[model samples]
Target: MKIDEIDIRQGTANTPQRSHGNCLPYVGVPFGMNYFSVQTNGAAGAWFFQPDSPRFEGIRLTHQPSPWIGDYNHLLLTAIQWDDATQKPDLAGNYRPTEATFNAHHLALFDDHFNVQTDLIPTAYGAALNYDFQQLELAHHGVAIQLPDEGRFEFTATGLKLAVSDYHGGEDQNLTMFFELSIPNFDAENSGYYDAQNHWHTATNGTGKPLTLLLATTAATVACQLATSYVSAEQATLNLQRLQTSTSATLKNESADAWNDYLGRISVRDHHPAVVQTFYTCLYRLFLFPQRCYELDANQQPVHYDTMAKTVKTGRLYTNNGFWDTSKTVYSLFSILAPELLPKFLRGFLTSYQETGFLPRWLAPDERGMMPGNLVDSVIAEAAQKGLATELMPALLAAMQDSDSKSAISERYGRQGSADYDKFGYIPADNYSESVNWTQDYSYSDYCIGQVAQTLDQPAVAEKYWQLSKRYLNLLDPATGFLRPKTSDGKFKPNFVPDRWGTDYTEGSAWQNSYSAFHDIDGLIAAMGGKDRFDAQLTALCNAKPTYHVGGYEMVIHEMSELAAVDYGQLAISNQPSFHLPYLFDYSGHPEKTQVTVKQLRKLFNASTTGFPGDEDNGSMAGWFIFACLGFYPVCPADAEYALGIPAFDQVTLHLADHDLTLTTANNHEHNNFVQSLCVDGEPFDAVTISHQQLMTSARLETRLGLVPNH
Candidate 1:
């Protein structure tokens, strides 16, 4: 179905906008089970149906008047009971239905997960349990199930009885049984199912029992001797009421306030649901990290880490392990937009060090040192440059020391006096070729240390790593104009080709790794002789034939190749090295190329089913899309400014707590691919660069576009 054709209902108090389409309706938070179809417009009419039990697969609907059953193959009824005129069901008892009877609803035909694999059935039908049901219909509010046949059915009330008839029958005939339906506290004791120790369990009483149907039946028959005692309706109601009054209430209130603020900042001219979804999804992904660790006490202040008695610790927790890739973009964006969270994340890193004695490579629930680089250096330097105070300097220094001392390079560039300082900056391409290239990973780390040292006013230390930053130069073969592995005597390794994979670096060739000079583009350009030659080589690299094997256990290799094709000749776009490549076009007198490449990449890769071009590497690739679509990208994330790229939307309005920043594109379309002119708050600007501070605090950026290059 077309996304634009779907109707959206924001569900306000009185006036709610309702539309008819098969679009998914979401409430509460975006990450939860909020995507579900509440209604449909067309031939179906107002057929009221709620997904089976929130925990089941059946879509139960209360039919009015005559029972109009459609294709029975699509419906799966787990349990059914009809209330005879004589007695009433307790309206709050847990009844277990037989598997055979339950499977009759077509739900069983699919997998246990209830994901329908086939689309053979157009509709379904079932026997109507003719009983008086209540009707309370309102748009985007609670659903109404009406059964008018029986005397005043109290479906909405506390007590009701329904006699159930199984689809299967026998001679003895389990003819009729009472069915009860009531909403219980989702987290209460003995209230149906609950998650404990990462596994779900249903307690009939206060005690945990093996989740077996026969066991549950035996417990029900035996009474109090079984697991937890069954929770009463009054208790269940109180629990649910408490939950609704507390967590749900608070979330609803906060979400409402956020929504109001969001709406107030919306621009009528450029608003689109796709844009909103992408923006909000990006925002959602951003919050997935630096987890919510601060548990407020009764006074609403954050509690100490020690207070949770070792079960819960207070420090910093984050989600979405996209460090290697995200450090290039997303983290840089966060460092600008949300400086307050920087220290918390740093502290989290420190806590990780304290716990494991090493900074994590890629962290989720565990330490996955999947990627090559120690990107924390970039994050720390960016944070420091942006004026976010962190205890990262010492940690970075220690990490650098560890990396240096452990490297084969350090052993080669041995210092006569200090054993630790021996050959500290050199990595030999001899015995430790593989490890040496990996050791070159420290080049960026050293660059970061230089920034951190400069921030701390330690010029000597900064200068030391600044020289070390030229290690990429050490690997550079002036003979071939490619960054190749070097021997101990400072000679280029023999038989080095720019395109061959392996020996030169891991997963990438010299053509891809040659652009590792993002830390110093001028030095790299000079090393390449001049801007003209640099531009030519960059063009060659972008258009170069793909020689690397496309498929392997490592998906990053594939992505690196893709991204490399977009950057200054050498970017392995599908890999991490090429992340800053597109932005480098600005320095090479080709900012328009950056714009074109960014637009092409973003258009090809998005947040849909086929969104990512390669392995996400945590949220790194995702962050790239976020930054690119938002209009600018951090070329040297260690620095404080973002180089402009083509923006995906005509306008993007970021609604901050205190102010809003709107970016508007003019003369923008598929045909107009270059920036003809630009302005910030009507002030004419010649450059396409923006500072981190401007992005976080500016009022607006009005960009005038054109078909040709502005220069």
Candidate 2:
């Protein structure tokens, strides 16, 4: 199948109360700096672009990672054909979403209310927009540009330049986005600025208003080039210059080629067409985030606006990703398929450390410090173990040590409750919300830091961190077989409710957060009992009721609803906490249970308008689906191995950087999801896990399936 055949809107059907991926129909190249999505209802706040809504507000150039994180540096572009001069310009129209084209590379929408059609295609830092007003009355055809908040606008010789200072907090309060747009030459009298009252003025520039630029053109169609920058207006102009000579057709082709290159990396041959479509669609979503926050100057040197220091700095930087989510799966997938990009991503993290003194936790243009732990350590560890980012690991390891030694002055930068965790060996429940999660995550991150240290040959430092990595054992409760939270006095918090959500856990209960000791699952199992007891507990976890108690939250959060929506018992694949739960059986010598559970989870996902079970959260869920279908999962990012599962596809060929690695399955059917045996290049293999080195070097892996458990 071709890239165009895949709909970018597969997981767009969503709401704040519940999510089907909770994604927007974003039209941009893979990892493009700017994404263009048609906003159907801007008044709905973050839930602005509904897939089925008939209302078409305008096309938005958005830097929104997730609705929960909110948007920054955004604006709306709308085409209008108004005959009246006295009326206020309304940024609303009606359009059929069914007829509109919403592909990854391009977006074309026909507004019936305005009798105009708009086409858009994106480059890395710029995009081309063409408005066709041939069906409108010849008397008037114009454009309305609206900024969500305070903005300054200047009419350029060719078109216009605007700077918006709008954000939903968590960055420099004075943060601004510089934008420039070049359009066909028009009459001087036809363009002006609108005041706060929506009244027009004949001024070349204006500021501090709900600013909207109105431009009337004589031509039947208007072609425009637009670019934005975090640096300055001069850099925005340079960004616009790259697209000056390119047309919509050329840009579309370029974007298509860019997306095809990434999506084509993994080819799956399945009897079901929808399965193939879903695989490619998930692959497309995988590369949309940790967006490029740096741009090039006249000499083509990388420079970025440092939000914390509030100054321009030299180096690559990235934003709009939460490390707690992506560290589990996103970077691991990159290790195999897009290994070439890992070095650059690692450098971005290094630049982040150099500027801010601590690596980012959640970067929406800058650190919001959402979630628990500095999970970017896992990202660095995985890269170092694979030898992808060797030059930067030493500096990054030093930065990790800094985080471990001291806490940050600002709560949004470094480890939370750092001093207490170091003193008590676990974050106390009475001191922090989600203390169990913070302790477990920090313990895993300690393991990751040790991995990087070992790779750098600092054995003493690695041993120190490796020993500290076992801190999760402090929270493990032998009675309930769950990791319970402890008070500041080092005693377990009283009244332990395993099914309670929030409070001591992050987005989940004890059942979901207990087995997160990624580097020490063996220790976790031994603490619980042995392999037999662990296997029984795993079975009980899968067979338990899908219920949740709103313990710490004021209301039922979307994650709780998503957990109850699915029928996988307590194994809530709707969120990141349960990503490795299916593979936990492998450690207990019950690989067949892992295989069956994974096969069952694969059926919940597809390439539909509502594709995902919950918040996709920057390709984390997509990575889970992709890995599960491919028959293995990155159970622990710091480790160099993948726990085996059942493959949904009959054949999958991974086009790696060095060579092709194909995975095939025999007797694989709907009911036959248990692996009886495995072979590597036709030689019998008996292992529950495969290493990164083995997968990269091997050419083919064959698995024979049966209906019953091999055990």
Candidate 3:
């Protein structure tokens, strides 16, 4: 299948209440600054879209990677029929989903209610939108530009310039979006401002109204070029001027060409198109996050607005990613296919450190401090291991250590409970939120920080963090075989409910959260009482009842509900915590068990509207799928070796930065699920683990398949 054949809506039909992919049907270039999607509902907060909805709210200009991370600096464009000159513009109309093209290059929505069609093609900084009419009788129509929150707009003969704020706008005066657009050069007589109450206003400064910019003439087609900036409205105008020459067709073709280039790199040949389609769809989603946020100056130097400082600064930056969510997968994928881009991302994090005096934990324009653990340490350390981003390693390492030494001035920038973790090995159960998972995550981050330290050849520094990483053992309860939360005085919590969700756990119960110490599973096994009991415990975790009691939350969040909805047992693949649970059996000498579960999971995902079992989370889950389907997975990001599993496809080839790496299986089929034998370059390969170096340099991997379990 070709890139254009791959539908962008494969996994995008979702609401916050329930998710197919928990993803937007985003139409933009890969890693674009903004993405455009049709809004099915304007009143809903982050869950504004449903692929099956008959309501067409408008076309949304969104910077939301996940509904959980609410969108910032957004606006919507709706075509209004303007039934009469005295009538107010209506922002919502009915449109059929069957009439729209929801894909990467083109997003076309036709409204039967208005007899108007809205078409859009996106660029990195902005997009080109075209409106087509069915009849000249409605030639007196206009466009309503709606802002969800308070904003200011100035309408022009060409288009409009406006400024809007992010979600956390009340306290954050720094977060201002400067946007400008160029269209049919409509004059003042055709444009007007209307408030949220539908009252036309003469002033453009207040927050009361949405701006209505009318067309120059009721032509058969109307077009516009929109540009957005974080720095100033002037740069937005400059961006519009820069891309003014490109037509909508030119942009649509260019966007498709760009996607074709990226998607074509990894080609899979299989008789089953559904399998192939699923592969490409997963590959497509892997590039949607860590969006480019900074803009370029006249001198071609990178510059960005400091949301924390509320001032303009000179440097490259990225936003809309949380390290806690991404550290386990996304950057590691970059290490393989797109190693060249790692240094630039690292530099962005370094600049983030320089500006804030601490590496960001989570940033959606700025620090939101959402998840537990400052897992950016894992990203830097993993990149350091790959020899990517070497130049920025020094500053990155300094920031890594800062998370260990000092707490942030605000809770959002650095590690939480750092002081408590330093004084006590684990946080007191009653003290912090999600203490057990936070303790485990911090311990792993310590090991990652040590990896960076060792790469810098500071053995003493490396040894220091390595020792701290093992402190997770302090909270391990030997009798119950769970890592329970501890008190400040070194005692376990009084009432321990193993199946209880979210008191000390992060979006998980005890079963899903434990066994996360990939750096040293051997040590963790010993702590839990040797490999036999550990293996049995792992087995019980999978076959045990998938039941939960909402202990902490007033209401069960979606993850808890989704986990119980499926019979995958405790494996909450709908979320990230249980991502590596199937692979954990390998550490206990049960590769066949891992093979069975992984193969079962491959069946759960397909290329369709409701494909993913859970939230994709900026391609982290997609990366996991890609790794699993390829027959190997990065079980530990800080570690360079991949734990071997069964490959889903007969032949998998990777066109990397330098060379091509291929994996081929003999006697391959759906039922022939177990690996019978393996060969690398025509020689039998015995080891279960392959180094990152071998994968990057080698050309082919040959493995034989058998119907029976190897165990």
Candidate 4:
């Protein structure tokens, strides 16, 4: 049957003027089972249409409503019984798609009339089906299903082909299809999902429907045609090639391969599955951004960003925006492995700076300005020290200068090396205290910049910043050893309670922030008067049993305040400040403590859904998990060394660009959480600090396990 004309409307009462964006058309044999539907007006209502099908004899179409908050407001459907003789549709007792049957994006339904309807709607930007679906077919951008009366069908697209031998049987029916779509100038609103308002509109109003249908049909066909056509020669060849390319390209960068393999070895060699998963997952997250922008042209030279722009953009095109939290793990991971991309990554940051003057705090699609810290300096310094060329140094230096001269938030917090910075290394709580965490954040940023200078070999500058890093010491209450907020005149904030919310900090308390001294451990230890006192304070902080009123923000505060909880002891395991604190015991000359604490943290936290103790922080916390599981922790964010923790896996093999690295654990198990002995590349090792260069070269290490030490 020819599809002469089709129209879709958002409202039931009044039909709006026919716009090109509201119409869609499809043509094929009336296979009696094919269907189509769409939700407009931001998922307010779903309109369904189906042909006919004998297989769907007992099925009828039913609509499922979405609840508030979780309510997608998009199209949803079910299947019911069909009366062939009477051509009647029964809705009372209908079968529904299993909960896992449909992704949040689409709904499925079948009726006794042998008809089915599949919901199609966009959820990101602003929810609206703003494309002319019929135009999609004419442009050769969508699939064509050819169904014969004998219950056989063939589906084909730009570069895909498939055929269904017998689709009439239930569950036993075989189907196949090939699919491809050369989607040009295609872009989706925010990860192809809608935000709170249930909108799916795009910024530039690009032709989204074409790309959406093309990709959706491709994916859906894979599920339906899985049994038969999926293993066909054409399909097998495509799949194999894709896999080979992915694996080969990943191992192309020798340094990246080495670092990745080293991380894998630490986890597997230690016999730690949790560590392996978390570590590999963290590594995966790091690759999600600062994407490899240079696509190989016919000659294989770096080409422009592979978008519709058609412009020859150089360097790497990395994108995931986790700058705020990455400094802890993700940043270090990239600096060590993909140092070649550092210049490009820095260039991207400069682009952001050029667009918004100040460097971004947390860059999303736009600059979110979230969190504190002029962390750019730390990244630059860390990258340069690790043999990464800072070609963007001139640009970054200029941005830092501009930031220093400005009297904005940075100046208010005494972040820029201004006159008041020495006297008040941090903005007193009284001076424009917004996010209560600012004081602690100020100290952290100072330490980061100081390390950056040190990495650059500017000792005088490094000394100045290093002293600033110890500014947290000034706020330390000699009575409590907790780093409480202080006034510019060197007085503690009276009536300040360490556990109270908001008053002392954001998301955490003084008890948690007390451990924010990772950047200057020696100085902190000295200030507290030696390893014994330092160890005692740490023990008290970890052992102190405390309950907190987490209330509505339970997810945020509970993990931070409950010190007895393995996750809470080393400062909120959920927060950024405490990420490396568990490994600080190594610096205290008690490597065993570090091992014990690392194992406890991993055990208590890495369960199924609770795989994370706090905000994943765009994989920063995940990075910590990966590190601890692999038997080492960065300890110091800007440093090139990692303190040894207990390893987590039995064997891990990392495939790198140049060579391969392996790790194995002897007598490794959950009960054996302490390291009795260790060796790297067949050599004996006394303590656990691996150099940045060694980690990136791909090697093997083995660890012997033992029981935790008794006090």
RMSD of each: 15.2, 1.2, 1.8, 15.3
Worst lDDT run of 10 residues, candidate 3, spans 208-217
> Candidate 4's residue-wise lDDT over 1-711, tens digit each?
001111111111111211111111111111101212322222222212112112222111111110101111111122221112112222222223222112112333332132233222211111111111221221111122212211221222312222323222211233222222222223221112111233433232122111211122212111121111122334423432332333222322332333344344322333445544445534443343432222333343433322223234444333335454677787776654444557767776665555456665554222334455566656765675565655555556557546543555533121433334445765566554422355555565566555656555667866766666666676667677677766667677787665654445655566666665656788878877788887888776666555444422444433433343443443556667667677777777888878887778775444222345545544466577766666777766566677888777776665545666676778886788788888888888886577766766748877889775533
In model 2, which runs have C-alpha deviations exceeding 4 angstroms?
Answer: none
Ten residues in sequence with the least summed lDDT for candidate 1: 220-229
Better structure of 3 and 4 per TM-score: 3
Native-referenced Cα lDDT, model 4: 0.45
Task: Please report the candidate that would top TM-score against the real structure.
Answer: 2
lDDT of 2 by residue, 1-711 (tens): 557887888778888899989888888877778788999888888889888899998999998889998888799999887655456656689999889998888899899888888899888887898998858664667788898788998887788889999875755887899999887855446677677887878688889658777777777788988999989999999999877877678888989998889888888888877877888888888999889989989999999998878889898998888999999999999999899889998899888878878887998888888998889989988888888878888888898888666776677877889889999999998888999999998999899889999999999989989999999999988888899999999899888888899999999999999999989989889999999988988898899999989999868999989889888899999999999999999999999899999989988899887999999999999999999889899888788889999887889999988889999988978879789989998898889888988989999999889989877
Superior candidate under TM-score, 2 versus 4: 2
lDDT for each residue of candidate 1 in 38-59, tens digit (9 for 90 to 100): 2212124322321222233222
Q: Give Cα distance to truth, residue 202, candidate 3, Å.
A: 5.7
Model 3, 390-470: lDDT tens digits are 888888898878756787566676667778888898877778989988898889989999999898999999999899999
lDDT: worst 10-residue window of model 2: 82-91
lDDT of 1 at 572: 54
Clash counts for all predictions: 46, 0, 2, 40
Q: Which candidate number maximizes lDDT?
A: 2
